[model samples]
Target chain A: MFDLPDAAALPRLRPASSRPSLGLIGHGAFGAFIHPHLARFFDVVVHDPADSASASLASVAARQIVVLAVPLAQMRGVAVAIAPHLRPGALVVDVCSLKVAPLAILAEALPEHVEILGTHPLFGPQSGKAGIAGLRIALCPLRGRRARLAAQLLRRGFGLEVVQSTAEEHDRQMAYVQGLTHIVSRIVLAMDVPPLELRTTTFEHLTRMVDTVRHDSEALFRTIARDNPYAAEVRERFAAATAEVMERLGAP
Target chain B: MFDLPDAAALPRLRPASSRPSLGLIGHGAFGAFIHPHLARFFDVVVHDPADSASASLASVAARQIVVLAVPLAQMRGVAVAIAPHLRPGALVVDVCSLKVAPLAILAEALPEHVEILGTHPLFGPQSGKAGIAGLRIALCPLRGRRARLAAQLLRRGFGLEVVQSTAEEHDRQMAYVQGLTHIVSRIVLAMDVPPLELRTTTFEHLTRMVDTVRHDSEALFRTIARDNPYAAEVRERFAAATAEVMERLGAP
Candidate 1:
């Protein structure tokens, strides 16, 4: 259902040798998970400060497409570092959990001649462990025409369901989506309830959600819980709702 | 996986005409849901004050096997009303959400000659709509050996997974399983968030869990959140954990 137009229905494709070079920053868990999928269509080069085998930042930034896979906290620094080396008309994409701030940073730091696409792939290494086919990716065409092509490519190449949204709209919805999910998961995990043998279907679904986000990095949690502009309000509302429920139940 | 020994391996079974009479009280949502399932193997008779078509209380209570599917608050009253009519050696079962208090009430109100089986079928009309195969039902043999036979029948006949435990153990585990799920779902529902266009896999799981319990009666919610002896502690722990998480995130 997520398939786009047949690969042959599009403009003529370049040969493998002439395929566009793509650079990826941050060889983190998500970066590693996505690297292979991106490699199927591009001559991919990766640069991560912590990886000894990574390509130099300058060479990686000069590619036709550059994807920033860094943490939200580090996005600005990476964007600034790559700005000087990014070739004109390069399509710069960011795979951040929150869209508004990261996209803003990319827009501010990148050269005006470059294109920007903001994406948040809804699945992660844990959720996408089997395969990413039919998974969702939210695409924000922050700047220029390349973002539309990127959305089409995401759909056609990877069989992803792309939801086209603006950075503001994406982050607004994510305040409830990612923000509420992560907070609830963290609370349940912290409650430290032992493994229960009497599992209900609802409880199993709740725990599955908890387990999927259990291994996520603390940085991602902070990004979703704090970095998103609307997340704090959502968190506060949830906490208030929880308190009201406890009060109604007369739980002291 | 929930199957018991083959039905043919059991002691010779009675023909359909000779099937033991089963009486069910409190034809509420759950009572109606389970009525057909019980009718499959027994000559089932149902009694409910609200259901005008139901059988008379005295006649229903005098059956060879009697089941009470009532709210936790009304359990004692139902047991008291049925006490004088229970036949000797009659197998009486109460399907309440919490096992401890209801089992205690049944033990106190019912005559010593009548057997008592406390069961918490971990599903209802909403979750069981698709079919109850492999669904779980907690069985507490409070006062009889007949509980084992009932468990076997539940497995072999209805494809139910029976977890046999004492009343205390059942309530304790359900404090986490049912208690946590209901409370979280209530909080999310009360938050009154609009339908989101951007949904993650985890969020989808969360919402699905919420939807399963959305139609549950307020009485069931109270039974899970207030009737269970251990539920308050779990709710308190969840509240405390939510506070800690919000504080850590610097969320007001």
Candidate 2:
């Protein structure tokens, strides 16, 4: 019974300046998705070395909250490159799926004057039609007063169910949530059923899962399955259960 | 583009009174599910040594279609016992998940006078609010004229997408559809995340699959995994794909 406050009841959070600015690091699907929503709230700037940030995004880079939404592997390098450009006391946040490692990277790379916060939006960009209406966003605070202020702003401004969890706890839970889900989906895809013959409700559900992760970049899958410390343990338990079932069924 | 004719267009079918009265060999969850739907069309009789047939199901025992909706391991025995009581020319059908092995058992045990057909409803009985509106139902015609008539009656009356496939083909595809889905759902359950921490869209999808299968009896799981010939091959492919991903990710 959590009563989410009405949007009107929340404090009118105008970005500290005449026109608040926001910078996003990863311009991939998730970044592109949140960009439109953030643009409504602040002047948004995005940096993705892999792809050119859109013209609209590039136009707003001068004065904004710089967000590093890159892959965990490239987060440090991206943060280092963008740190010099950010205005003093500009709020910096990384939207990496994994937290602890990236949070540490952002803390060490950015200037002490710039505030840093690590966030992982639990839903994916492809969750089309099911917008971020009832979703959880995990926020792990790393740096100064501005970082806390940014988290509060997200809660007060957008009706986001913000849960404060340590970077370690976040990754541990993510191992089971993200790591096992992808693994299970990959296994289902490997079954190689000719699409014509697939007709069960269960098969359709499994195919949905496979379709969700299969198109995702290899780097993203690897980072989720290997880089996150809790992933290995979760994977082991999944493998054990699979083996046990196979043994019981005497399957090859 | 497949055009499935509406139920009203099909010829009005009447159960052949000359045939032996219908008999239901098992009164389990699946049996109870289709029982009401079937009762609407034909006079029905049930004989479940394990569980007493409900009063309503027992009331229509005089002469009707004989259905065996039992666990795979007990199916053959039930078929043998019910064979003696079936009225002459009674059309026998099974709602078992696996088809090939059970088809063979029914063919061997039932009296030649009694026609047998193996039927597998693609949707679960407990598919609560989402009723079997657009679901596919596989019908493997095993014997006589009565069996064909029974299959046609189901297609015409229920508006079910009735696909005619051999018992072998049905079992082969089921390996990927049922076996793989169950294996993936069980793996998600084995991950052992605290309920609060598991909030991802992918996780929610996985939990729905687990919830669908967890209420299923072990005998049901075993039947799909063990009795179905195609299950081992599907399981092997799933295992291989999982191993390939793990190896690619350099996971020990």
Candidate 3:
């Protein structure tokens, strides 16, 4: 049932039984997209309540590594649900767009015995439809030393560019990057501009940018526009700058 | 002093003496960038008041084909200046971002005996730096049948995609295409976003779009935003859409 055509070609140097056990807690778009890649290096057990193929939450959370790929709105509830079942020294990783809030929630909800790692893969099904190699992932070490090992594994094994950053720093930069992009995309999509035969290179670039973010979920857009603390300031700056541009253009 | 490395390799089946004489006004950025390409098919004589290397205005305007590449604000004055010198059978071509106003001015100022054609090469020095073979150029036949010959020559000789459209229809499409792009670029540039380490594919696309129009002249920006009749409506729609997005996100 898996759509991975490149699964057979993956290097199977180690046996499945000898690999570490990875517990995945969601079967949404991102969770499903990352399953096969994680399966190559770990024996994975999924625990999505909505999916019939998932294992029990207790059994999945007892693995050596637990990955929370649920939506940002559900991060706190899921973290609390898995806290009691996590084993000592287990690493808890989160793949969320905004790091500060989710990482804070994980730190307050999960047990101190378990290590916490905050990661933003920076790509999804649309961008990684072919393969995820050469893509970027931000690693934020929230509560332990395991983030370095995770960084090394992602860099060497998956051919990813790992950028080590703190939750605050990541959120600050994303305020402009993700925040501005989603805002512009949403506004342009709302404009509903008609298709035209005459287009310039700059207009094509704007169209491609809008197309990339058009398929993102409303929850994701909300997380990017509202969840990040610095996002409001960036949006304000953008609005003011837009007003200045309109004034300069003598817009009626 | 031209930066064109592909000049020598251009097809030269016909001798220079047999080619039609082309008078080019305004040795500005676009005029200079397009000079070599026109030089391949015609004997070019440039007339720029600011450039010492330019020929006299009378001498340049007397050629078989007179090309007006001046700024939109200066278009009426230049058209009036050349009206006395234009030959009866000569063809006049204008390369401007917005077609309707410039074409109207040319029709009003120039003699009816000379033909008029309006063209907008969608790429500039930055976008066409490598080569302009596959680039697009919008051709609006304003006054006469000479536009068809110009289209065939651009399509066959330079491998350009010539889109035949009327001046009004071209301006309507461009009000969204060029107008929105330049407006968004100006606003983003005014925002002064800092250098970000963590960037998504969509953010990169936005940055590249801004970069493409970042170096564009303010005159061009003004022409795209002010010269087109429908531009004000687009800006109003974009502003209203931005307000809706902000309201949906509960922007404080």
Per residue, candidate 3 scores C-alpha lDDT tens digits across A157-190 of 7889999898999999999999988999899999
Chain B TM-score by candidate, in order shown: 0.93, 0.83, 0.93
DockQ of 1: 0.80
Interface RMSD per candidate (angstroms): 0.8, 2.0, 0.8
Best by TM-score: 1
Winner of 1 and 3 under lDDT? 3
lDDT of each: 0.87, 0.70, 0.87
Q: Rank the candidates by lDDT, best first.
A: 3, 1, 2
TM-score of each: 0.94, 0.86, 0.93
* Candidate 3 lDDT, B106-209, residue by residue in tens: 99999988888899999998888889999999999888766666777788778899998988899999999998888888988999999999988888889988
Question: In model 3, which regions exceed 4 Å deviation?
Answer: A1-12, B1-12
* Sort by TM-score, top down from the best: 1, 3, 2
Off by over 4 Å in 2: A1-18, A51-62, A146-159, A196-198, B1-22, B52-62, B128-130, B146-156
Off by over 4 Å in 1: A1-6, A9-15, B1-6, B9-16
lDDT of 2: 0.70
Per-residue error for A122 in candidate 1, Å, reads: 1.1
